[model samples]
Target: MDWRSVDAALFDLDGVITPTAEVHLRAWAELFTAALPPDVAPWSDADYFAHVDGRQRSDGVRAVLASRGLTLPEGDPDDPPGARTVHGLGNRKNDAFLTVLHRDGIAGYPGSVRLLDWLAGRGIRVGLVSSSRNARAVLGAAGLADRFPVVVDGLVAAELELAGKPAPDTYRYAARLLGVPERRAVVVEDAVSGVAAGRAGGFALVVGVDRGVGEPALREAGADIVVTDLADLIPTA
Candidate 1:
């Protein structure tokens, strides 16, 4: 909770820094609802929170499939969308998300941007850690591509063989990139998995931005503090 003691801050991309979570939510709903058979229950927001939110694309697809007692081949990452495999389904979801992103564009949350500016003014280092492979593209669309010097995203996780959120590896990797120890850094997350990651990494502080995930859930997931907005953390000048 002591801001002065923190050397670096690691942030989650979609729900925390930007409102792309809604975009992701809609895309996932569309993909799964269309894929389900007539007798199968339609995909719902609860399903997204449980199986897809804050997870890698293919991993989310596999989890969702498992939930429905279905399984698919682990197709190549380069498999085209609609190829009828895990990777293909994930790719299809990505395509849908991209379509929405390109059509509607995106902007960083004002509170999040305010927090970034506050951290910058304090000379604190910043990094982005996200399970989304589209982190870069989303950041670019939101005009925040250059704000973070280090981004530990799904692409980098695959390259380094780091486990995704709830594992802490990506957050730890980002701290290392920022030349800070895990205990000297803070993590801002909006997802349960991400808060768990920060806790598992032994970071100095895990701040949860409760977008839709309840405050109690965030705390149970290991957040040291929970706020409705990052603006709450900014110091009065």
Candidate 2:
């Protein structure tokens, strides 16, 4: 990839920069397995990739529920964590995630941090575009909050009514915030939804980080280039 040609880079938060995707996966499994009726299949990683990963929390809850022929009220965002509504279940998952985060802090993948440093050295602006509402908290726990000047996270999306991943609004918003056009910015993501968003947004390049989703899947999702790690993009000194 020609790093010099891109004016900015947009990155996803969980699987792309940090391993918090594991934390999220565990939380979701616990929440859904406990809540779902025994007659329904238990939540699994496959379910997550298909219905939840890279989506907003409440949206994820709806998707997962719909997959299982279940439905819940679209409860208010302020609904308590244990409420039975969709927002409530999503909140419950958030609580579980926060407990894990506080118990065990997070760190960015070394390769991702290396790429961030390289981009900084090149004076290429970087923004975070994530469907996770806890994006700020995760970044703070990982000690990486200061690295990104623009964050188009779930909170921002909700406030602005911007569509989440699988839609291009958030990524386009991030690029605009960085004072760059979609065609001049690159997107780095680990989720198929995120890759699709980048492609839909018409980014100059969409680089997929294949943490577990597989390279072929990323390519099919519209990633221009797929790598196992962000360090693969670093230019040799």
What are the clashing pairs of model 2? Answer: none
> How far out, in Å, is residue 52 in model 2?
0.8
lDDT of 1 by residue, 1-237 (tens): 468898999999989999999999999999999887776677999988888889999989988888888888998999999899899999999999999999999999999999899989889999999999999999999999999999999999999999998999999999999999998999999999999999999999999999888999999999989999899998775
lDDT for each residue of candidate 2 in 133-210, tens digit (9 for 90 to 100) = 999999999999999999999999999999999999999999989999999999999999999999999999999999
Instruction: Give the Cα RMSD of candidate 2.
Output: 0.8
TM-score of each: 0.97, 0.98
Q: Could you tell me which residue pairs clash in candidate 1?
A: none
- The C-alpha stretches of model 1 lying farther than 4 A from their native spots are none
TM-score (C-alpha) between model 1 and the true structure = 0.97
